[model samples]
Target: MKRSFENPLIGDKVYFTKYATEPGSPASIIDVELKPGGGNGLHYHKTFAEHFECLEGELSIQVGKEILRLLPGETATAPAGSLHRFFNASAQPNRFRVTIDPGHPGFENTLKIAYGLASDGHVNKAGMPKKLWHMGTIILLSDTNLPGFFSLIQRPLAWMARRAMADGRFKRELEPYTR
Candidate 1:
């Protein structure tokens, strides 16, 4: 199935427009656009390393406490297990392509969780619902190893993804593609 990640952070700044599904191996191409200072907070993927190629503007990449500045036409890799974050540091806009290997099934949902927490403006009780939902969604989407619960786990995700994409809420959430 095809899906788009509606980021709850910048309100549709970036979009995970296409997803490719192969039986065993996982991979995806993401089109990313970041305005000055726009980026996700610090985080790491447990099993996915995203190789990024800049299509426009400059990007500031932060990996494990070190900052690297990347210009247009440059490429960088954020390996799995590394704490990394990136942002558009230039005055103008920036665009890039992120090719993630061994696709991460839980990446999109994790953004929503982080956005929800940020929405409350503090990591406190108000954001608990979002945090819980984030965790729950991940379990449902990724815990296919559980016995007899595969269908139950996947059904809600399918429904939610469809609804979000159709409503334009998905686009509003991602806010990742704006110049």
Candidate 2:
């Protein structure tokens, strides 16, 4: 098991961070502060649910068909496969944290890839590309954790994740990892 600072959004006044606990557990914590009109683009997790808690200002979270406005000390949860998005509608960046259940391998590695792409000047302020989608399938097929048929699916699955990350719908905040 490895632990370190990886997520791009970590700092005192700008953004927060995400951390993975233990190994093989599907969970992560994301801390963030969104500036006025700043928010996370719409996305969904097919593997685990995401819960959020507002630490400062007001947070506007959209879970499926319902949009919720959570104030300080408030919290909300979005179940797996639910379309969810969050933002700050105030003058200051809204501060909050997200916990994603059911972790995955190279969680930090994925962020590094996205950040590397962004640093090359390919990403927008929102961090999302023009398009992006599910790339988890790629990891599953090529993990090498299992042999036989599972290994056979690696190439195709990785191809799909690459394509989705290149042109998926939601953009993730990314940064190179450092300890």
Candidate 3:
């Protein structure tokens, strides 16, 4: 297995073991270890489904209006366009595997850029970039969207971010990951 990437939102490490673009693979697999009180807030993907398999410890997953607490060897699925989120509500660390169907465009690079930005102290307390341009750039690059009302502005926001990036204002932040 390859080394993991540090994702502040999920945990200290997230291993991208398999990519969706790999020949014969239909999805991307990610192994994550979530520390106590760490987890992703409500979010959803519009184009790809997501499945989670608990590997160790406990994981709390919210799919739509339902909350599923998964134990070791248990699993759950959230279809595309479903509102979902995951977190470790226990005191102990939790480990799980996530599979994203059809893969997300620039998924790996987006993770790297987010983590790298956090490492550089460029993100806010929620692990999101402090600058709107940076945030928009990530959203556009990864094809990730916030649920509900926030989704309404994603298109225009992405357009502005893309314009900034092209003009060199946000290019520096994406340098390491893009190269």
- lDDT at position 53, candidate 2: 94
Rank the candidate models, highest TM-score first.
3, 2, 1
Against the hidden reference, what TM-scores do the models get? 0.57, 0.59, 0.87
As a whole number from 0 to 100, the lDDT of residue 139 in candidate 3 is 79
Clashes of each: 14, 15, 0
Instruction: Point to the candidate with the largest lDDT.
Output: 3
lDDT by residue for model 3 (1-179), tens: 23467865445677887877667677888898889888876877778888999999999999988999999999999998888999998999999999988787476667777787887788888887887877788878766778778888888889878888789876665756543
Worst 10 residues of 1 by lDDT: 139-148
Give one digit per residue, the lDDT tens place, for model 1 in 1-179: 32444334454344555453545446756777776767755656666687888888887888788887888789888887676778887788888888778665455544444444456442344332343333344434322222234435546665664565577744564323221
**Predicted candidate 2 versus true structure: per-residue lDDT over 70-124, tens digit per residue:** 9989999988777778877777767787776654435445544444444455546
Candidate 2, residue 136: lDDT: 40
Instruction: State each model's CA lDDT, in order.
Output: 0.58, 0.56, 0.81
Higher lDDT: candidate 1 or 2?
A: 1
Candidate 1 is scored at a TM of 0.57
- Candidate 3: residue 27 Cα off by (Å): 1.4
lDDT of 1: 0.58
